[model samples]
Target: MSKVFDFSGVDDFCSGGFMHTNPKDSNLFFPLGRHVDVYFPRKRSHVSAPFVFSGEVKPQPSIEVLPDECLFEVFRRLSGGQERSVCASVSKRWLMLLSSIHRDEIFPAKGNLDPEEHDNTSISVKEDEAFKPKEKVEFVDSERVKSVNEEFEGIDSDGFLSRCLEGKKATDVRLASIAVGTGSRGGLGKLSIRGSSSTRGLTNLGLRAIGRGCPSLRYLSLWNLSSIGDEGLLEIASGARLLEKLDLCHCPAITDIGLIAMAMNCPNLMSVTIESCTNIGNESLKALGRYCPNLKCITVKNCALIGDQGIVSLFSSAGHVLSKAKFQALDISDVSLAVIGHYGSAMTDLELLDLQNVNDRGFWVMGKGQGLQKLKVLSITACGGVSDSGLEALGGGCPNLKLFGLRKNLLVSDTGIVKLARAAVSLESLQLEECHRITQCGVFHILANCGGKFKALALANCLGIRDINFLFPLTSICHSIRSLIIHNCPGFGDVGLAVLGRMCPKLTQVELSGLQGITDTGLLPLIRSLEAGLNKLNLSGSVNLTDNSVVAITKMHGETLELMNLDGCKYLTDITLSEIAQNCSVLTELDVSKCGITDSGIATLSGAEQLNLQIFSLAGCSFVSDMSLPYLGVLGKTLVGLNIRHCNGISSSSIDLLLEQLWRCDVLY
Candidate 1:
């Protein structure tokens, strides 16, 4: 009775499968008859018909999750260097999936793979399976992604192992790693490192890592590295055999030993930029010339140790292969110039700045040489002794020159410019700044001959140019001038600007700052002529710009104008801001400092939902206050730098609130 096993208590005794139910008990048991004739159940039983074999029953369809391969395919789309590292640490599955991805697909062979390539998975498989175990990846605390000098205590114990494992997540770590990984996977075609100098010296350990990581690195740039020495350079040279370009900037620790070793080891090096390295001299140049046969570009700047001997060695060794040479602040004389002229047959671009010892004789040597025939760009600055005759010689020698820049050459006059214009007829850019002796007649002659081909012409602080009537012929002579800068030219007035505005419709940049004589009359016509073509307009200190001028410019060039400087124009008010807010939706930089704009104007500009303003300077605008501060909070997302200095009406509390909201913007009070 307690067990309730009797057939009398069975509800379905006649059926093949019977359910037992005790009258005293609430529970009921059913016998599900099958292969072995065994059955059991409880409570409410729904036993029906004669039981057949219970072993074979169709299962109901159930929901299935995505497979690992499909999940990995989803993750493949997120595989960037930093993205992959961050995702790999999410789980073991993601780590395996990222590791399985082909190295070539991740790093790429040519240029970086397009973002869209990560989405597709049907790429051709590799011919051979030579798999190497992927290095274990860990998430770099984005907060800890700073210089090694910044209290990263345990990083050095592993001897740059953590840095290599962290990969590109840590910027300072990767800066040291760039030397290692550049050519490691196959060939890192380009490597650039601009050091902060705060990290402890990237010692031999880091250097060895670089050598092992980047074997095929073609281009290497190390800047402001305070501690890297000869050993580091040797390691780089040993690993990056195909290095074609090397830029060493402010690396005072590097000496002739390092430079020579690099030149000797990296045979493919074609370009060398060494700046502010005091220890590298003539011997380094000789090594480079003797070892690097393919040398094409040599830029030696702020290097006081390089003398005439070094110049001669560099020219004698690599001059045949050299196509571009830039020497700045060096003490080489006419002898060095002669050496360059004699040996640099393939030279196309030459820049010499502050060459105190170079004079007309040096230019004469270059003018007479057949080696400079292919020279296209010639820039010389502060070479006081170079005169008209030297310029004439230069003009005649390098007839293929397309761009010429001469600045602060006290001896240069109208004669030199006229001679240069006649010889370099294909010149596109002519920059003659602070050349006081260049008269209107000289400019006229230069423009008459080369104006048609001129793409850019800058003449700033030229006191002798009183009349620009010569510009009247610009419509017929030059229609291609894209950049015209005549800043601080007291004689250049409305008439000059009017002529230029009518002639150059494609002007992308027009800097007429400090031309106080220019009023709305000169400004309106120029902005109207340019329409939407102008990208930068500098009318600061013009003092004559008003709401009318702002309205006209914004209406015509709202879409294209990215930078507008109305600083020192005290007459501007809320109307200017309103017009700009309504029309110039894409304006990124607006400098209305020292203007008469008030709180309402600032509010209007900051509230313009469409304006993507990044830099807003309201310096000396006394009327901007707390009322305007709220509108700036709305711009907090896009703003990068804001100057609220001299805005006496704004309260400190409001400024603090604004600062808290715009935490990213550099707020200057």
Candidate 2:
């Protein structure tokens, strides 16, 4: 009789005494007393329909369900991963709905789900015509699919199926292979398999499917992913246990057992970029100082088997949490400069130190005093072993130095730029590109004492800079020069462009590329006193600039321009780019490379609609073609980095409509 397990008609029902068909009937009563429904069912239920009590049949209104915080707001809109498997296949009341949520907010613990849930399960199994795939496998494995459509001729159609399934997934392909299967390819938290290096047979199955699907991957970029190796980087240091930024730049089949399996499995690795790997030496810097103890930043560039015992085991193990180090600028020319002069005085918050091709015993071990006053950007380019006593020991030890790049440091002359401009008085940006034994007395001692806190002054190819008289002591002593790059200075002309238009009146960026003795009377009075503090203007290869100096500098400062580089100037034409698109309405980056304009100078830059342009370089302009790409797609919807490299009369269908009107471009060289 106990078989009548009635949950009191179940609405939040509660009852304990069940499963007892009278186990030996030990007076637990329901045996005969109270007439336990007389030991059974008179048709299972008392179908008592005769009572006809019109208002008392109210037993169906028991729906007080929505509890678990309203089932977690319907599991936070069915928490991703294909809407939680389409809300767990919508049934069994949403499979007990969000069965206790929190599994990293319903998935995405690296791969398995979220890649927009494997592209919404490959567009719902390609619109499931009875779960598709009994065919579609032509990505490699051919001899059919019409010889894979003739090896996809000149390819297209997503690059011949992404070069024959580079996303590999076909083993008996189940239901369109569940979004690149193997649990939808591992956790790619920050995995950027850059330039896949011609994928040599799926590079160890994409590094063992990202170490068995991103086990909570933590930033891993195999930059040149050259057929990865060392057993797929020891299966990514034993499956990325929360790795932390590791970029194997030119991954030449990694060595040192993948840096001893990422120093015995990524111990909270911070940043490690083996630039030109070169089989990492010094036992991978003593196994990254015995397992990345919070390594800060280490970039071993052109690693010729890193010397100085791998920079003294990387500054004796992460030189106090190294704030950033890029060695192999010729391995500090075989370490000296007192072995980084006492580790650069204990690297007190080192802020970028690239001893490029270091010499002079690593610049007298980085000029003795080590603590480079909290160095702020110092690059000794082509460090012919620095001279003038390592630029007077880095201008008396980096006094809050502000960017000092000594390019091609051929024994930096002018008494090492007047003792690094009298000990860098907080020099604000100084790059003596191609130093060529600097002259004009170290350019008038940094335009007379750091030109009032100069802001960028690159004397490119400094041929003992001929006069405009150091631009009148750099515009009356650096009136805070906002970027003034003098490329191939040819001793500047127009009397140094009218003494840089009377001492840079707050010059807003200017580069006189190859100044062939500036003309137009020094760019028409320096564009009428830099027409209201210009805004980026570089007359590339200014072959004595013509077209009346670009129509008198776009007629008095083309509406306060915004980035304009007339590359190779070539006697400017097209009426000086249609008077700079009718008075440059705030131009936005325009480089007329090798200009000889055509297509009517891109139809006067399609009437530069208020020039809201965004990076447009007509590389080596060959009289524009492809009919000037539909007028450069009306400035390709606010472009972004579009350099029509070698514009040999544009074709390839004008780069497919300039990549469909620069669809949010990111560098289309």
Candidate 3:
């Protein structure tokens, strides 16, 4: 023994877990067993712990004399950044050795560093995957998870697999695995992280590895991730220079620093969606405006710090190139709207929702700004400022506008509707919902003034609309209309339906759900008036309707009918199902939930000659029993989905039997 070097107790140095050394254990110092302090950066705040090396050492030896393998283990044992930094600064060789140690070996990943072990679809989030941390999970997409490896030579553009990690799967080990495994392939292109564990999951370490390895990443989405902050995003901005689209939601830890850096670094960025990010404000938006000239789509919602300054700066620089923009629940007032209207020459779609600060004057100014020449679709909801004058001005401002939708705006009435309709010559469709002031006259004016080009109309929850204004009958009243949806209109009765049936003869796709005012008297005439059979029909929650309406619709539109929903029509019986089975041969979907249909109705439809139905739902049909199981099983050849959820009469054994019979069907019992 030349220097009495004791390397036998080397494993004791790894007392601390994967990402951090045990602050209370002094074994990390190894031969130099002296009391020390350690810090964990992932905690966000500076958190330190004192290590008490109370035990006496058998033989004290210099750490500089340790072998390469011993040094490798020691370096690998140190989890957090501070410890690694402290070690690396000691010498150049230590720094190189520390850099050489891979994250997967240190963190102990679930997947091995090989092609077979890597799950191209997903990755883990915890440091010690073997430790098995509990995490709350959101939807994990398994789309194209099974790789179809059409191998060519070295790294094709589509060679690397797009990964989606959520819950426990979003671990640093998995990120390390993806970094190491997919780098040889074309590198990770797209990644999504949705919802993490109750405790913190992903940190800067994972993103750092991703930065070094998957530099070619293009699209990224992060949702409900509280642990990730500026450092993690900074790493992404530094490496993924070619990134085009980024969507961040409910990530409170990420502030303007991260967003500004990303905007500055990735000049080719095209689309960005920022929702409920409290820390993000004008600085980040200003950076995007100054740096990202190629920005096309921008949606900023529920960010308290964002104001008119941010919106003005963004639209002033990049609005001409933008195709779509949505601003919701922001602090911005009329100034932002005016700036957007002034610069959004190329924008085709725009939405303004829940904006409390902007008033009627602001809306008027935006309309008269005369810059949104190419705007096609516009939706305004829950805004205080959208009045009749503003609507009138907007009609003249956006001449090319094809579709206009208004929701929860109480100030708009018949005057605004008629004025907008007359001025907006290119308008083809109009949708109004929860707009209490919109009377029948407003709807009538839209149809009359839209110059017979109006093809679609949807009216829902408008208590004031006592049907259309038949008193002032215009010649061109929805003559070209094909799709119509009127629901929850308490004032609408048979007279209204009769009027619509006569006016809109070309109606094909119709949904009149939640309308207790109308029965077969109004509906049957509409079916008879159609030039061609209806393709889709939904009469859900129309409890007043019976077999009369169902039988008439099935017989009239039998050939063209593809989908039907008669849910909550408790009066419907086996007769309705018999008509659907016998008449609607090409029907692909049918829902009769909460109906009075018994097993006989289901049995009759199950044995149809060419029912050809793919999706069938009998949920809440208490009359349906186990007797319909075998008959439903016969539909396995063509049926892809079956729902018998609330049928208390059917036993679990019968459901199991039906499951055994139907191999391809997705049965929900």
Candidate 4:
């Protein structure tokens, strides 16, 4: 009975003999104690089997009091993710016990589902499903995830790697457990502590433990950890010699001294991100350029101390191999731009934002220089320095530029677009936003000259494109335009939309979000004109949109559509949902948020045999209540993400009931 006692309110769990479980925290740990060969029930039946007393005070057996062999049996029998979650929620003791169980200890549910479905397979699977599952794709693999052999390729085979602590769970005790546990397990490959926590719970003591134990660590990310300082970082620099990637954000305690130490020690670094760390300056970046030659990607944002001297020095040595770079809110001038243009021979993608001191001459020098011929992508945002002449210079410099994006630039006019199109013959796609000075003449120039290779165009809040037909003739038809996006352009009425229908006939994906002026009359023609058939269509925030446009779209192009969003289309009802369910055969994602959808609408769609959605959103659908929950359960097998936010009519108990029923889906209520 003592073993089965409640392990609650025991604040100093390390000194006392109980687990102080934080219900809200994701990361869990156990205090140092003697081994008792922990175990659990083997079967769900054993867990639920109530004592049937024979009218006597016979002691009942508890899981906590069971033998070690019996405990391991129950843990083994708990195969599915749903069952494991239920077990963890039973009490704090189970959580701490489960923390020590390694990947090899738990066996997968062999006859049945994937890794996600098999709960007892690995701590990797458990952590993935339980903590930050949304960061993963819709049951798809992330490109960042490396194979087992590649993850631990050069390192020794004596470290148990990979631990992530976020929100309230990032603590010193958990860090200590990770540091000590790696000795018995394998080597540490990756570790990350993110977001705000309980009074900056992790400090130098915990980080020092990790540095001493984890020498094979390859990747590390620390964000918003104000308590951890240069001492802890120096320890990591001296101990973790195989570190490859480092990401630091909003970490006020870290400075150039700490980062320089890492750069000098870890020569194998391939990628680095530094954001909002005011204390870090050019010295740290210089160390990276001088020591880390294998680096490929560099991102620096909101670091005011990084001026032209720092950028020039960093790129001078690292520019030969660097391929991707992004700089935002930096105090750099034309000197940095000129230096980058001179040495950036291998650069492919570059983004520049909020460089207040840079002017048109800097861009002109970048284009007029001898480098940047291999550049494929360039995005500039909120830069007053990028004027018409500056764009002309850039277009002339980068001949192979495939994609260009500009946002919130007040200096770009119609002449710049024409000149840029004239100079850059290989231009493929262009995205423009908040350029009020660029009128229909800019669109005319692009379509006229770059029509052969121009395939995609996205315009947002650009006042210059109101009347496309009035500016010029319709002879410049772009047959290759596969994607077109026009968002929040209320001035673009039916006339402009109809003109677009004839101008772009091969569009495969299109978005007309927040275009309140366009109605069924304007949308029906565009839907009918597409020759390649639509793959994705988003008409969200179209308040005037009704069932007429939706029904027609489904009847024509629903068979090939993979994703559709009609969020905030308040006029839509059950009829539209029924039409979609009956026609969209291969549709995998659907969003009708903020619509007038009711319980009957959900039932009609959920009951339909043709529906097979993996992601569904019903946010702000006030008409929906608890009655729609059962109907939604029909898609439990296919759905991985379900959003029920702002649904006022649904009760909390009902939400809990729905979560239990749809154990596989991530319900965001």
State every prediction's TM-score relative to the real structure: 0.65, 0.33, 0.77, 0.71
Q: How high is the CA lDDT of each candidate model?
A: 0.71, 0.61, 0.78, 0.77
* lDDT by residue for model 3 (73-187), tens: 9877764433443454444445445544554456532333433234333333331232221332222232211111211113325655588888876766456546544543445
What lDDT score goes with residue 291 in model 1?
A: 95
Which regions in candidate 2 have their CA more than 4 angstroms from the true location?
1-182, 186-218, 221-238, 241-262, 266-286, 289-311, 315-362, 365-378, 381-387, 391-404, 407-510, 513-519, 522-537, 540-547, 551-575, 579-669
Specify the poorest-scoring 10-residue window by lDDT in model 2: 170-179
Compare the candidates by TM-score and give the number of the best one.
3
Please give the TM-score that candidate 2 achieves against the real structure.
0.33
Clashes of each: 10, 13, 7, 10
Give the distance in Å from residue 596's predicted Cα in candidate 1 to where it truly belongs: 1.0
Ordered from best to worst TM-score, the candidate numbers read 3, 4, 1, 2
Q: Could you give candidate 2's per-residue lDDT for residues 1-669 as a string of tens digits?
A: 243433333233333343445544623433333333222222335545432211222234322255657755655454344344333333323323333233333333343534554442233334323322244333223322211111111312221121123222221121111212222222235545555566443455445544643455666766665667788777767766678777777778788777778777888888887877777777887788667878777767777776677677667666656666656443644353455445543343332234555555556556555555666766655556668877777667767767777776667687777677677787788778777778644665566566367677778887767763443433345567677788886876786667656656567778888888787877777677753557778888887677887777666667787888888887776777788888888888888888778887777778777778788887878888888877777777787777888888888877876786767775454
lDDT of 4 by residue, 438-495 (tens): 7765675676667378888888998766755555566778887899898987787777
**Better model by TM-score, 3 or 4?**
3
Ranking by lDDT: 3, 4, 1, 2
Q: Give stretches of model 4 more than 4 Å off.
A: 1-160, 166-177, 195-205, 468-474, 596-607, 618-663, 666-669
Error of 3 at 630 (Å): 2.8
Alpha carbon RMSD to native, model 3: 12.7
